[model samples]
Target: MKNANLFVDEAEIEVHSGTGGNGVVRFRREKFVSSGGPNGGDGGRGGDVILVADTNIGTLLDFKSARTIKAPSGAHGGSSNRKGASGEHIEIRVPIGTLVFEVGDTADVVELEESTAIVDLVEDGQRVVVARGGEGGLGNARFKTSTRQAPDFAKPGKPGQSRQLRLSLKLMADVGLVGFPNAGKSTLLRRISAARPRVANYPFTTLVPSLGVVERDDRRIVVADIPGLIEGASDGAGLGHQFLRHVERTRVLIHLLDLEAMIVEGRDLLADYDAIRRELGRYRPELLTRREIVVLSKGDLIHDESVVADLEASLAAREITVRRISAAASLGLDTLLLETFDAVYDARQEEEKRASEEARHHERVGRPGKI
Candidate 1:
């Protein structure tokens, strides 16, 4: 069996709406009546293809195998003035924050020159109609008029719509975790929330991003542990490049550092930090300006407090504060959580303020004579 919870962020599929049913031409033949009028019934309408956002679903893995989606066709009309039943609509459930885009003609073409923005599903239970069903045909009875006493012809049903679409899933979280491989990101996530991601003592252990919800004092905050990054990650060197977009919407970022790895590999802590920073800058310049907290993982392995103090001093010299925590030892986790909550709260406040200011500016600009 496949992993049901496997993380899949991107998918491409073909969607087709159901076609309308055909109308029937019939006439009533009674014993007493010489010329019975046309009594044919109208056909039923086709079904539509709808996309619904669901918070329970986390990935697009289900759509990977099922590439084509088709709705049921409508029923044909009956002979004795009986209308056919309409086809049932097909609703596909997807994860929240899923972006749907219309695909171009070519199969391999990922980006289209002129693409239509179908829908951006950001809220749970939100739905969008991707394809419209065909219209039903008119029966022969509808064609009877004063000029034409008995009409035998019936109108054909319109064809349904079909199109190819691309779905991209971006994780929605309040905080994002960023670091190199084996930086204890997975461990930290496990310590903070109930999400138990695959944890091992190796590099690239976490191949996919995992989300965890942290609740404190009736306040809930979602955190995403993004895959580890290496040099040239911005240039698509590792798995981090594939998941970098998931972190773009986070309000805060936690930069986890593996102090034990730096010590074992005889690497400078500042250099490692700078390398990650460079990758973030290369990928997106704005990511560098996002509010971030630096953390040193595996504090239990480091016996010398002076080493941590020196590293903290170096980071402080650059106007960056550092925090240390050991997930295995369950140390400093409470303080980390509290501090993270504070940072998240501040970031949210700032974002709300900026949005309010922008709304006011737009209102002022649109008023009266100000073009």
Candidate 2:
């Protein structure tokens, strides 16, 4: 039997807004009135199609089964100058970083910059109406004038049109943890943070990325656990390029090491680390150069700290600063958090500094230049 692939990385969908209600025409009559003026009721406005950012949603798979979205139509005009009922608004639930694009050749569409990872959708409810309903027509009463008494003509309600939009979800996180399968990456995350990612004694227990919030005093950080990568992950091997792209927005990376797995499998832990680096280089070279914290996990498995100490010595010999931690016993967890937070904060400050300098340079040159 073949393995069932349940991953949905990308999807396309269409959204539309509600239409406006139309106006109606009517006449007021009485026993003594010779020619009563036109009194037409206006039509109700059409429902609006709204899109909201939801942090709880992790995937666009919900939109996979439903391809098209629509809003309610405006109610027709009523008699005695009574306006028609407006259409109801339709709210769409989308992942926070979902980007929308107009589907057409040379179509100029709007782009929303996802600068903040933790979007407060509850407070503001960032909403955008994809399509707007047409305006309601004017009633005959609205057209009444001294010269146009008892006008027989009344305006008709306009119809709402449809548009094609493309939605794409981009995973947002403060830090991303990357490594090979069964490298104690999940164990480290579960130990340091409150994220309860599925942990097991086997490989590939995490098929999807998970996130956790780490808080220390008044400071809080979001840590992401990206799925494991294999030898040819860049070219689509073992859950491939799909999961790698999720780490693109992370501020830092934590690479976990399993000392025992390396010694028993006849594999060099450093070499395994290098293999992952090579894959990162192949898939995204920038990822290889990002701020990373190297850690040797399951340190308590060995009899003495010398086993980890020897690995650290070897890494230091290669100019790599390694941090060792035993996730099971919660050893070195606090130090790991302190170092990671400081590193991530420093990296962010440096990035901000560069951005400010670039902006200043652009101001001086009166045009944007390459950074």
Candidate 3:
């Protein structure tokens, strides 16, 4: 509960678009002529409900208390061929990586059913219309013909669309830092980026995921420090289920290990690593396949370099090379950042290549063939 603000990722709200304005029936009046023709104008269209993605906002905290969002209705048409004013659109700002789901059966008396995926707002300034406004009805003047002398009736405007929407936010980052509690992940994040996450010596100091932007060689890499994981994390132990989902979108993971804790607390380094891996595999098998960089933190606590070398050698046997770094002393940090950035850049290139190949394959498969 320390970082409660970061966990407000889900919200459900109802949105209603503006109704169209009604057209009025009027006749043009002249100063000299006794008879005048119909001059009534058409009504204006209604407003739309739109969702905008904003990078500044990190969570859906704003929508937690908001139950319903309504747009302003269009103004009614006036006499003498004066058109009605269009309704103002209602815009809602959400996090950049928000996923919008359209809820079905939103009646007050009935229970809501499963929601359908509408759209994913991933980039800044991206927007999507959730509900459309009702159309305006035609005026009586439009129905008037040469045979008809005067029309007295006018059409009303149609109602706007209304529906319930669910907004779910998933943090998007190039690197994700994962570890047990008090593994110096928060300290490392603060040392590398401008993010000021609350760091303490106790366990579970970071209850929520914290994001920071690291700049290297004129390039920016966003890193997310997820909360610690314990045994049985996949089964919701120690609120691990809430934190693990944030790591799914990361391109690379920095698996931090506490060298000091291994010695002081008498914890085995390999066991700690495997336990976290098991949880990740159980929660999502794909997470196990992600590229991970093992990091042994708190090098300042250990005086002898052999201790660090021994641990590195042990992990190397399992095909995992460990990077030794001390956040307090700022030792080996520059190398760690450079290596992490390189991994992220390489992963991005591979992803783009795969996507291009898939697109070409689809195009070839969908092309016309001779009979």
Task: Give the number of the best model, judged by lDDT.
Answer: 1
lDDT of 3 at 311: 67
lDDT of 3 at 116: 37
Instruction: Give the per-residue lDDT digits (tens) of candidate 2, residues 190-226.
Output: 8768887878878888888777888887777878887
lDDT of 2 at 231: 86
lDDT tens per residue, model 3, 114-204: 2335788889999999988878767768879989868877778778989988777778899999888899999999999999887998888
Model 2 CA deviation exceeding 4 Å by range: 1-9, 105-124, 304-310, 348-371
Q: Write the per-residue lDDT of candidate 1 for residues 160-267, one digit (tens) a residue.
A: 889999998888899999999999999999988998888898888888888999999977899998889999998889774778888887888999888988679866
- CA error at residue 135 for candidate 3, angstroms: 1.8
* Candidate 3: residue 81 lDDT (0-100): 73
TM agreement with the true structure for every prediction: 0.90, 0.84, 0.91
TM-score-best of 2 and 3: 3
TM-score of 1: 0.90
Q: How do the candidates rank by lDDT, highest first?
A: 1, 3, 2
